[model samples]
Structures are given as structure tokens and as C-alpha cells.
Target: MAYKAHKLLEGYEKANSDNLPEVNIIALAHFIAKDSNFISPEISNIKAMRNGRESYGESAIGYVQLKREGHITTVISCVAPEHKVTSNGYKVEIVVDSSKGEITSCKCYSCIAALGGCKHQLALLGWMHRRFEDKTPTEKACYWKKSKLSNVGKTIKFILVKDLGSKSKEKRKNMCKKKNKLSSEIIQKRKPKRKIYKVKSKINVRKDPDGVSFLQEVIAHMDCKLKKGNVKVIPELAKIFLPVDKFDSIDIHSLMKDELCDEVAKSTSNQTDNPLWRRLRYLRITASNLYAVAHCNTVNGSLVDILHGAKLRETSAMARGTRLESQVLQIVSKKQKMIFERCGLLTCPEHPIFGASPDGINENFTVEIKCPTNYKSYFNFIDSSGKIKPQCKAQVQLQMHLSGRKKSLFCVASPEFENNRKVKILPVDYDENYIRAVMVKAEQFWKNTIGKFVLE
Candidate 1:
């Protein structure tokens, strides 16, 4: 199974490109086993040992230490329970294969399962599992509270101005004499020395790569539509990191477009004919893809599409639909006395991998405008009851989640509509359960697939 995301630790556990230790078998096992809900089948062996009276009470395991050495985990128990073989309590050391979740060795004298796990090792495992499951929500909250107080105590120690009480006058005078003597010795060593000679050195500096030259080459090689086969990249490097089998099929120009679009958005220049602006106006997800996100099993397809790295090229029909949406939004805003502001790319605050870019938004609601290209497209998006069809539900739900809004308004608009009656507005509420389901698929796609490659 791929790694599962923890919502509580989302912000704290960021990906480290330099050292991705989380994906290592041992580290991944430790993280999963720490969660209270994790249940391994090997735990049943511990229960069988307990039923046969092969171990002591649950409290026998004490001062346990767990350390990961390479792919193996070494567990040491400082205090162990006494058994029939020996009177005095024995110390135990258990070696575990973290990847396989099996005990490879034990140091206890009474153990018989040399090829397998013995009672002492199993008992320690049960103890650790129970310890995590035993913690209640209140206990966890109190633990954090005490941790904060302990930090505060350490921080406040430096502000103390005086001791609780004074000692004798002779003792104070002796302490002052020792402090003055130490201060004079320190001052003697702190004197500065004059330089006798100086040597000069010349340093070489390197200039950074300029993007304008690269952009010119890309533009010259690009197709007439400016979609794919525009830029060249190192295939072997991409293959070692990316999940795709064919690097040549992956559109490298799309990444350049993303960077250029970001530069255009952040720049203060007011020029309307910027090349980036011309490309950005036509690059957006199509209505057909939006429907798939809401109604179809297209998560895998979506991930593959992202890996392909193709830029969006708008056709004449797509341009007509975009213009229709804009015209309808303008007419609606004036008639209803409502304002709609354009939205930028938004990522979920808690889960950054999942992202959305809605059409527009207001204070109370998220706005998702869809302009159907034809009658078939319009009917496909509308249910029999004249409501916003279920096919586009997922898009608005994601929009609300990314925008942090409570509700969303899904609007279907076209230039042919004369009044509000021809247009449809459907209200969609936020659904956390649905969002979680989608995030699970997204997490697997990111961690197991995209995470395999290192971006340069």
C-alpha cells in the first residue's frame, strides 16, 4: 500500500527533497505503527503467547528502547519479567525486520523460537501497541498543555533578577573578588593585534542562466497551435525521476509555460500584449474534463494527463464558449446587483497537493460558471428536474474546499439565454467525506507516482 496522509500532522510533515526518509521501509513502518488505528496480523501471535501463560503481566515490559539501524529495528528492554527458567528478571533484546514486520532474533535465555519470535519479544510488541491505543483525547490534550508550560518555564528562567535570599557579607565579598580576577584575565587575552602584511585575492563570479534565450528557442520550434513538441529536455534524467515510460511524449514546454505564467501574474508591468498573457488566456481545463472529475472514474486519467505535460490549446468552439460565459456573467451581475471577482489558482490550506481554480467568487459563495458548447452538452449537464447535473458536482465541491467557503453556486450560462429563467443556478454544500475520498486517490498519485522522481 502507498503512504496514507495524516490530516492532524499535514502542515508539520513537509516533504524534504534533500532527504526523503519518510519513504524508507523502516521509517514508513514506524510512522504507521505509531498510529492508534494500525493493526498488524502478527499481533495475533502475541495474544496466543499470552493465552498459553508464557509471559508475565502487562507491566513487565519497562524502559523499552526502539532504534532503527539501516533496514532493521533493534528493541531493548532494560527490565524484563522472571520466568520458570530463571529466578531473577532478565533483560531482552529483540531484532526486527522493519520492512517485513517480523522478529529476527531475541537475547532472552528462555526463548526457544530461534527461527521465529519468542514470548518476551511478542510481549513487548503487545505492550507498545496497547500503549498507543490506551491514550484518550483528553490525555493527548493535557500532554500538549504540559509541554507548553514546560517550554514557558525554561524561557522564563533567564528573566530572574536576584536570588531568593542573601548569604553572608564575607561570602558576597569573596565572590566579587573571584569575579574581578576572572574578568581581568579575560580582558588581557582580548587585546587586538596589528597586521604586518596583507595579501589580496581575485574571485571569479558566474552569471545565472537567462530564460529569454531559452524561450526564443522554444517559440521557434513550437507547433502552429503552440501545444506540444516545443521544448527539449534530458530524457534519461526525466525517466529516472518521472513515472512515465516515454520521456519524449512528455511535453516539456508545459512546465516552461507554468513558470512564465507565474512570472506574468507576479510582475507589475501593465503591458497588455505580453506573450505570457496571450498564452494564459487560452490555457484552462475544458468543460469535458471538469465533468469527468465530478461524474467519472477519471482520477487515474487525470494523473496520467498531468504526467504527460501537454499544454492546453483552445479551439474555436472553446473560445466561443468562454466568450458566452463572460457575457452572461456580465449581464447577471448588473441585473442582480452582485459582484463576482476572478479567482487565482488555489491549493487546499491543509493539503497542498490538491488544487482548484474556480471561475469567480463572492463573500458568501463560490462561483462555477459553465457555458455549454451545444444543446447536447447543456442537456448532459442538466438533470431531468432542471437542476445542475451531478456530473459537475465534484468540481464545485473541490472549489469550496480549496476556497474555504461553506457553500458554492453552480451556474450554467449561454449567450442564447434572454433572462434568468434560461440560466440555472444550483447550490452545493461542502461535503468533507467526499473530499476525503478524493484526497486519498490524490495522495497515492502524488506519493507513490510523482514522488519517485526528483525535479531539477
Candidate 2:
């Protein structure tokens, strides 16, 4: 079964490039298995393992394989990052081959199937429809199902778009015979015996503040703007000394990678037109990104590599991408102060003892931003009936508790583009008094969730 894109996206990678995007398959599998909600979670835990590749590399790239009228069709995709305006975030590549009309082989990127597309698939699909679909009679008719039978079901489905003849009838009968034989053999294969392995009880590890002080230090460094990208990652030596390979271990993350991401975005694409504006934007990003990084980094639970890296100016681009990034960020901070004053947003007596930043204030109403690293397919801010979206409400409620505001709003930033940028808002309507009660519960939960960990 070949992967066929709606469009054949071949040779489309001249568009955008990023860093090393290929990920280990086992890591991808383990991530899908571990995450209870299949969503990525930010954590403060640190562990390291020593392992190397023990298997084959990925096979399919650029296109996803899907069921067509009957046979497998590969749908190629072209991705013109959020920066590419020629596309509406996603561009497709569809091509139909001569020998195999609906068949497509993707030569573009890897794993655009389950994740997302890049430029390669876009070119493929475009060439297929525009060039071939018109000139050939066989191209106009998809006899794909007429040639294959019963991959998903026992019955052979015949779709009609053209008149059939003796030649067509013979082809259908022969294909159905091949399908039935294949189906019977498939059915004869015995199901593997299910194993009944005894599950071990989960041990609650005590959280050790002394042991985790390294993590707190790391976060403190992040506050100073450190630790980002693959260059010069801080190592956690404790994991090196400790042996955690007794039980099978796996990392959990759906890695979205692009080897040419930096190249495409930086070299081929448009640079921000204004340097001053870029500086101002970087400043806002640095602050908010640092704040989020700080909160996710709990005390006594982070790593030493991150700790000192955050403090170092030279090693961590995140800590200090350029002196320019820092200067612009400072300007943005001043700009933010001006915006708050102009918009009549609230200014607290001082910054919160906790990590929350106040986003907006009109009269007594306050809104907070909880920037998610990724955005889901649809923005479910409010349902069809106009009720508050549960996810947005929960995020806003967390900010409210931290800000001590009765009511709070949650604003989401677009994840498709640059970091530290956002759009759209969802405000949680709740009384300060009522939310306070909820806040107490939440705070207690945070402290207690790791309460057992403190003992470890």
C-alpha cells in the first residue's frame, strides 16, 4: 500500500527548513502510551537513560497512507509554515502515477502523515491534478476499487462512473477472486495468546527539596533567560550515577522536528521588516516565556544542566539569544507598562508572590494568559450554545487563584507561529469569593500532589 496525497507533493522542500526533525520510533510509541490524555504535560521531574538505536529507521515520509475507493492511497502534503502566505497554513501535494494511476510515493519529509505536512507533498498533488487528470480517460475514472476487493470488509463494492464492458467484467471477477483468497488466508492466521503479567503497585516517591534544589536553581536561571534549543544542553549527573534501567523505560513526547527549520525560516523566508519592532516583540516573548518556564520548573525537581545554563549568558540562546534580544525585551517591558496605563489594565501593588502575570483589567474584571505550547485543531473557547469552554475555564481559574481575582479570563496565543505570541480570549466568569475557595483547593492539590514526592 503506497501513500497517496490528495495532491502529489514532490520536490517541495525548497520552502522552509528547520533543525533535526527525525525522532526515534520507540520514543513516539512510548509517548502515545504514557500520556493519560494523549496530551503533552509539563513536568519538573528529571531522569536520564543510556541507550542507543536498536532498530530500523522510519519508512514512510512526507505522505500519510489512507484507504481510497478500494486500494491504499498516499496523500502527500506541503507545509508552508505559518510564515508562508501562499498557503493557508497547510498546502497539499497530490499526484497520480501513470502505471498506477492513484498510487503515489512521497519523497518529501518524514511523518507528515500523523503529524503535519511540509512543502514536498504540496508539489506532488498539484502536479497530479493539473497535468494528468484532464488528458487521460483512465485518469478521470478511478477504477481503484474495481481492481481490488475486501480489505476492510468481506463484500466487494463497485462504484459506477463509467459504462462497463466484457473487459471490465473480467477484471472485476479476477480481482474479487484474488481478494477472497487473500481474505481467507488472513482469517486463518491465529490470534496471539494474551499475556497476563502481574502489575506492580505504584510507589509514591517522596519529594526531596534538598535533592531538588538543583531544579529550583535551574528555574531561577531560566528567569534570567537561559537554557533553550539543542545546543549545549545541561546534563543531569545524578541520573548518570543512578541506574534506572531495571525496568523498561521510555520517553513521552510527540516530537515535531524539521532539520531545515532554521534554514527555511531564516534564509528563504521574509525577515521581520522592522528591527525596532522585532526587538520589542522579542522583549515581550522573553518575559512571558521566562515566566511560564519558571512556573513549570518546580523547586528541587529540575536539573543542574538547566540550572547553571539559565544563569550563563554565552551557552543558552534562550537565556540570551543575542544582547539584542535582551535589549528589545527590556523595551517591551516598558511598552507593556505603557499599554497597561493606556488600556486601564490593573497594576497590582507589586508582582505576585506566586508566578501568575496579570493580562488585562477593565473595571474590576481581570484576564490572565495561560500560554499553551500547542493548539488543538479547533478553538473550543465557547460551545455552540455560547457556554464557557471547560479547558479555557480551567486555565483562567488557575490564573485567578494566583492573582486573587474573583473573576478571570483565559487568553490563548496562536501556537502555529513564533513562541510567546497569542490570540483569542476566553474569560472565566466566577465570583472572587467563589474562585478563592476553588483556589485554596487547587493550591492544596499542587502542594499535596508532590507532597509524597518530598519524601523521596
Candidate 3:
């Protein structure tokens, strides 16, 4: 159990991300009313950002251009409601913008922030799209894209994190009932038998099958139901079957920023040809910059001010009451074990990992007794704002990628140092480019700078 916390972090990440509903604001607003003019062009952009249109950069504001019609849904529930779904509903407000008089940008704060898609959004959509009746596919959608909800409609908020149907309820009840079946909370060992039966086999097929042989058989037995040819695989794999991304590869000139090359240009003070420190610094800086751009808000042609009330000082308060900021985080994390669903609903996917399990897992997504110092340091570096101190998602991404999971939940121990911690379900999209970049920087530091003398 010494390493129990590690598994807990993984579990926390997995459990938080599980089956929460995602409803598009544009679609939801339209469904509410069309004549309502709250849906903004920026909100529409967010809906189209994830499509096939490739835009590459540290942030979405500069590089991405969304052309297709943006679709946003008010809110949808994974859990099927009994007579009525009470929790899954919201009033999605939108602001439409036209620069040079073209429809663009949509800001959907209420729709995404509060998981709601009740009749409010639908009615709003209806009002916007008055061309049709209060109900219809096209009318509902158009209304959402152009409408604004009434002041009364803006007050609803709901929580629909999972698909809890009648069947699920019964299953949950059965699980609860099974908990009582344990007569005693004790580990019981089986009594030893006097002598084990020994049978001598004449056949010599007992050669121990090593991993390679087992793996060969595993590969041979696997099949894809949809494959018309033996070589066919999922369509997604086929698209990116090309070589690794050139942006972070041997073609360093194309992928890396000029700042990295500038490091190599520096005069070497170390006698050894390799230095790890400089390389690590470069890796950290590049990754952190990208992460910062991703997390900083950009809803209304404005980036959110992260340091609004943050106080910066080298001084550490020695008073017991003030010295307990970190302690509160630990306590809050411990108390939040019961109501993880609430955390999942509030958590943002853009956030970084928290309370990590050190060197536990490799790239495949795992954990162990201990990990390399670099990995542990990465987790410890998180700041009080519930943001990772390194300001990068690389390490967490590596953890999730290694675990073979596409998403995980990250909880920030409350900044207010409260007893209850807030959790966010972060979606980790593994980028081999990032992993390779970090390694390359590590290697360069060891080979060409003062870092060669230090472990770094």
C-alpha cells in the first residue's frame, strides 16, 4: 500500500473522465430560440475547431480558422431520466460577431459551464428561428445559433455526468447489497493440504513460453471484424500511418523553435561535450509555453487574467495558520473521495495533471513503487492555483498514454485551502512529438552543455 496513492491518482483520473455528457452550446441555443441573438461567432468557432481543418500552433486564436457551420448543443444527459431528466439542462447564451460583416466567433459560457439543455434553450431557439413552428429539426438548430435566452431561463444548471438508467440503478443497488454479504472484514487463508498430488506426464510440451512466443500467438489469433482484407485496420490508423510528425523529429529545423538552436550557439563552459542542464531548461521552456497558451482563456477576443489576485513573494509565512496552504490541499484531496462525480462535472479538460503517481508507469500507462526523479519533480512542481507549475501537459500526457487511456481526471486541491477539493476531468491526447522533443532536449543538454556535469 506504500504505492497506493499512485493507483489512486490513476483511478482518480479515470473515474473523473468516465461518461460525462458533452452538449454543444450552438445547437442548444438554437433549440431554445432563433430570434434570440446571444450566440456569438466565437462560440461557433470553438465548435468547428476540432474538425479536419488542420491548424497548428501554441494557441487557437492565431492559427485555427473554422469555416463550417458551428453546432452547439445546450446539454445532454448520459443518464436516462425516469419521468423527466431534472439535472441535464441549461440556458446557453451566445454572442455573434461579424468582422468586416461576415458571421464569425461564438462565445458559449453558460452552455459549456453549466451542463444544461432544458426547454429553455429549445424555446430560445424557437424564438430565433420563427420561420418554423416551435418545433422542427432545422428551426430548432437555427434558433440556437442565433437566439438568446430570457433572464429567467439563464438561472438553470444541472448535473448529468453518467448514464444512470433504471437498469443502472438496479445494478448499483445490487452492488450495494453485495457489500453487506461480507460477514467479516478479515483476510482468511486456506488450510494447507498434507501432500499435493504428483502426476508424471510422458509428453514434453512443458517448455516455458516466454513473452515473445506468447506475443506471437496473441498476434496470430487477433482479428478485425470489419476488415475485408487481412491487412485492413481501423480507418483512423490508416490516415496517420506516415512517419512520425516531422515537426518534432530528425528534421529539427522544421519542428523546433529558434530558441533551441540558440542554445547550441552558446559558448560551452563545460569541459565535457554534453550538458544536461541546458537541454532540460530548453525542453521545459518550450513545453511550458505551449501549455500556457492552451490554458489561458480566449472567449471574447480576450484572454483570461490568471494572476488576477495572486500574490507573489519569496517569503513563506511561518505562522501555523498561514503555513497550512499545502496541508489544506492534502486534506481536501482526502475528503473528496466520496463525491467524485461533482468534481468531474466541474473539472476542465484543458487543465494539467495533479497528485501524480511517480515513475510508476511507462509510456503504455502504468505505475510502480518509485519513479525517476524528473517524473516525481514534475508532479511536485504544481502551483497553488491548481495549475501544474511546469505549465505543461507533457508529463501527464505521457502517464495517460503509457496507461493506454485517452483521458483521465485531475483534481486540484482547493486553492482556498478548503476541506473539499475540486476535480477536473482532463482529456490527455498523447503527442509522440512532445515526448520526442523532451528527450531530444535532454540528450542535447547532456551532450553539449554544463548540464553534462550535473544530473539535471
TM-score of 3: 0.20
lDDT of 3 by residue, 7-37 (tens): 2222122111111112234433342334233
lDDT of each: 0.45, 0.31, 0.27
Error of model 1, residue 142, in angstroms: 79
Models 1 onward score TM values of: 0.36, 0.29, 0.20
Q: In candidate 2, how many Å is residue 253 off?
A: 38
Candidate 2, residues 1-456: lDDT per residue as tens digits? 453333333432221111111112332334324533222232321110101111100101122222233233333333323222232223333333321222334344433542323233322333232222223233333211211111112242442322221226676789899899778746644545335321111111111222223223222222322234332122221222122344323211111112222222233212233232222221111222332332343533432222211222222212222223323333333544432211111112121112223444433445544333223222345455555555455445544543355654454444332444334545466555643454444333333322222212
lDDT of 2 at 242: 22
Top candidate on lDDT is: 1
Q: Evaluate model 3: give its lDDT.
A: 0.27
Please give the ranking of all candidate structures by lDDT, highest first, separated by commas: 1, 2, 3
**Models ranked on TM-score:** 1, 2, 3
TM-score of candidate 1 on Cα atoms, chains taken together: 0.36
Checking candidate 1 for backbone clashes, the offending pairs are: 241-453
**How many steric overlaps are in each model, in order?**
1, 58, 81
